[model samples]
Target chain A: MTSEIRQFLFESLTVMKYSTADMDDDTVLGPAGADLESLALAELSLRVEDHFGVRFEEDEAEMFAAMTVGEFCAEVARRVQTASAT
Target chain B: MSRGVAVTGIGLVSPVGTVVEEVFDAVCAGRSALVRPPEGHALHGVVDVAAIGPAIDPESVIPPKDARVVDRSIVMAVRAAEDALADAAIEVGRDVDPYRVAIVLSGVGGLETLARQAVERSTRGRLGISPFMLPGVLPNMAAARVAIKFGVRGYTSSSGTACAAGGQSIGEAVRILRSGEADVVVCGCTEAPLFPTFADAFGNALALARGWADPTAASRPFDRRRNGFVLGEGAGVLVLERAEFARARGATVHAQVLGWGATSDGYHPTTPRPDGSSAAESMRLALRDAGLSTADIGYLNAHGTGTKAGDAAETMAIRGVYGDDMPPVSSTKGVTGHMLGASGVVEASIAIMALRKGVLPPTHNLDDPDPACDLDHVRGEPRTTDVAAVMSNSFGFGGHNVSVILGRAGG
Candidate 1:
C-alpha cells in the first residue's frame, strides 16, 4: 500500500512537470518544496482520492498546506484503510 | 480624423492557416478551407458538412496535466496570443509593463468542458464532478488563462456576445487604450464549437449549412444558391497599442483601428431585423466615430454568413449606409466558414491585410451573386486595388451588432 501511494504521488507530480528524481520521504510538497500552485495541488488531491477510493473532508483539505509527499501518502493510506473498514 | 489606434500585430488560427500571412494569402487566393468530416466524425451525418480545421493538440501548447483541465478553446487563445506577442516583438514582463498591458478575449464560453463535466456528473454521480470544472467552463477563463500565462496584470475582461463577441472585444480594447488605462491591449476571440452537442444546437436551429455535395462549396456567402453558414472553430488575436507607443518600440504597424460601433436590433433573437435599420446604424456610428464620410471607405469585409435572411439583411443595411455607391465588398466566410466569435477578429485581420497588401480578398464560391445582395461584390478573382480604409461587420444571435473600421497606417 505504501509503495502504491508513493508511486501515485511520484507519477502525479511528474504530470505537473515536477522533477521526481530528488523527491522522497522528507521532500516537501507545498510552499517549502515543489511549490505546487493551488490548481496543481487540487489536481493532485483529486487524483489521489480517485486512486484510493477515499474522500478528503472539507476540514482536512488544508492538511496539504505544509505536508510533504510522504506525509500525504500516509494520510491517504490511512483514509483508504478507514474506507475499507467501514 | 482622430489619430488611429495602431494594430501592431495579428495572430490567427483558422481553417485557412495558423499564421497571419499564410491565412491572408489563402484568403486572397480564394482557397476554401471547408472540408467534409472524416468517417465516424461525431457530427459527420448529423450536420452533413462543416469547416472543421486540423485538431489542436492542447498538450503541445501546455503541459499535459494542465492541458487536461483547461478548455481547448483557451488553448487556441494561448497559441494566438503567443503568436501576436511574438509578432509585435513585445515581451510582457520584460519589454512592456505587465500592469499596463491588458487583455480582452471573447468567445462562445467553454461548451466543450461543460458538456463533458455534465455528462460525467450524470453518469457517475456527485463525486464525478471535477474541482477544475468551473474554471474550465467559464467564458472568462479565456481572459484569465491568458493573463495568468502572459503576466498581464492590467485590465482583463471577457465578452460573451456570441458571434459579435470578437468585434466587441477589439472595440472594447480600443476604448481601454483611448481611456489611457492601458498602453497595450491584446484583444480577440476564441471558439471551439465543433463538438457534437454544440453542433447539434446549431443544426437543430437550422442555422448550419446543409445538403452540399462538395464540402468545400458548403459555405457560399453572397451566392444566390447559398443556404446557411458552415460551422467553424478557431481563434484570432491582435496586439493593439497606442500609435506613439508602437512607433517608439519600432513595431511593424499592420493597420490602424480607426473606429468601432455597436448596437442592438431588438427585433428577434435568432433572425436579424429584416429592415436592417439597427445594423445600418451600427455601421453609421462606426463611420461617424472615424469622422469619415461614405466616399472615404474603400472596401467592406462583410459578415456574410450565407444565410438567406442574414445576407439579404446585411445587403439592405449596406444600401442604407452606402446607397448606390457601395464600396467593393467581399465575405471571407466563403473560404474559412463562420468561426462564430472568432469570425469577427479573423475577418478584421484579413481586412487589415487587404489594406496593407493593396488587394481585396474575393468571396470564394460566389459564382452567382444574389440579386438582393447587389453590390460591388469581389468574386472569382482577387481584386488588386489600393484599399486605404475598410470596415468589418459582425452580427450575432440575440441581435447584437458591431462594425469596426481599419485604415492604412499613416496613409
Candidate 2:
C-alpha cells in the first residue's frame, strides 16, 4: 500500500512536469528541484483529497516535510484505513 | 542619448489573439472576445471567453526536453520573446551580439505545478516529490528560460510586483539599456493563474466576480454595476533598443519608450490608498522622467480592472495628475479581463497600436460609466486621433504602482 501511494504521487508529479529521476526516500523536498512550493502544495493537497479519499488538516504541511516517501504513504494508508473503520 | 528607448518589436498572447495583428484587429473592430461557457461550468457575471487566445505550442519554440521543465507562464514568455525577435527581424546569433541582449520578465504567480505537487506529497509521501519542482516553480525561471533559449548572456531578472510587474519590467529594461548595461532588452510579463487554488483564493477574498453563470458580464470595469475583476492569464513582450542602436541598425521603430515611473503605496497589502497619492505620484514621476508635461500625452491606457475600489482610485489618480486636461482613457480589461502581471504590457501594446494607427480603441462594456470615473473614456467605437504620446498605468497588489510613457518616434 505504501508503494502504491508512492507510485500515485510520482505519477502526479510527472503530470505536473517535475523530473523524478533523482527523487528518493532521503531526498530533501524543501528548496529542492521539484518540491512543490507552498501555493502548489495547497493545490496538490486538494487533488489528493479527491484521489485518496482522505482529509488532511493544514498542519500536515510540517509533518509532510519531516516524513520520507515511504513514511508518508504509510501515514496516508493508516488514515484511510482508520477512516474506513470509523 | 537623452531620448527615449525605442520599441522595435512587440509580442502578445491575449484572449483576442496571440499575435500582434490579431489582437490589434480585434481591438480596432470593437469586437468583444467574451463568450458563454458551454454546458455546466458557469461563472457568474464574467464573460465565458473574454479575449481567450491560442495556446502556447512548445514544439515551435523550444525542444521537448527543455520545454518539459517549464510551466505555462514560462512557455508563454518564451513564445512571445521568439515572436518579438522574429518581428524585429533579428537573428539571435548573427544580427546582434548575444552578450548585449538582456531579458527581463515579470509575473504575479510562479508555477501552479508546485501547488499540485504539495498536495501529492502531503497525501502520498516525500518519496513522491519530483526533483524538478524547485527550478520549475521559481519566479525568475521564465527569464532564465528565455535567456537560455536565445543565448542571451547579459542581465536577466524577474519581478513579481503583482499587476504592475509588466510595466515595471519594461521600465527596468529601459533603464538598463539607457545605462549601457545592454544595447537591447526583451521585457514583459506572463501569468497562468487559472488553477483551482487561485480561483478559490481570489473568490474567498471576493476579488473575483461571483457570478460564474455569466462570464461575459462577470467583468464590467467602470460600469456602475461592476463588482470585481475576472481572473485572466496571458503574456505580452516587447523588444527595446537604445535609440542610437535601433537607428543604426535601420530597425522599424514602433514607438519610443520615453519614461517609466514605479512607486509603492506603503499603505496597504491588497488595497490602494484612498487618496490615490502613491498612484498619482507614479504617473507624475513617469511624466517627469520623460521630460514631458500632462498636455503632451494624447491617450491613457488605464488599469481599470472594473473593481469598485480599483477604478475609483485610478480615476482619482488620473484627475490629480492631469487636472482638467485629461486625455482619452480606456481600460482594455473590459476585453482581456485582468492578465495580472501581463496587463501593463498588453495595455502598452494597445497604446502603441493606437499611436501607429492614429486611433484609440474603445472601453468595451462601459455602458453607464460610474460618476467617479468621468474621464473621456473612448467608448462604443474606436476613435480616430493623431496621438503623439500615451501613458499606460498598472497598479498591483502590495501597493505597487507603475506608469510608462510612450511617444511616436521622432517626437
Find the candidate with the highest TM-score and give its number. 1
Q: Taking the tens digit of each residue's C-alpha lDDT, what string does model 1 give over B27-103?
A: 88877888777777666766777777567788877666678788878899988888898899899988789999999
- For model 2, residues B1-411, the per-residue Cα lDDT tens digits are 645589998988887787776787776675656555334432333333333445677756766545665677878888888888888887667877998999999895455877878887898685456545766788888888888888888888998898999999999998999898888999999998766676667767878755545566666778888888877888999999998888889999999999989999999899888778999999999999999999999999999998889899999999999998899998888777788989899889989988888889888778899998878889888889998999999999999999999999777
lDDT of 2 at B80: 85
User: How large a fraction of the reference contact set does each model reproduce?
Assistant: 0.29, 0.06
Q: What is the TM-score of each candidate against the true structure?
A: 0.95, 0.81
Worst lDDT 10-window in candidate 2 chain B:
B41-50
Model 1 chain B: worst 10 consecutive residues (lDDT sum):
B1-10
Off by over 4 Å in 1: A12-19, B1-3, B40-42
Model 1's CAPRI class? acceptable
Show the colliding residue pairs in model 1. Answer: none
Give the alpha carbon lDDT tens digit for every residue of A1-86 in model 1. Answer: 97899998898788777788988888777778877766667767877877788887655555686888788888889888999999
TM-score of chain B taken alone, every candidate = 0.97, 0.95
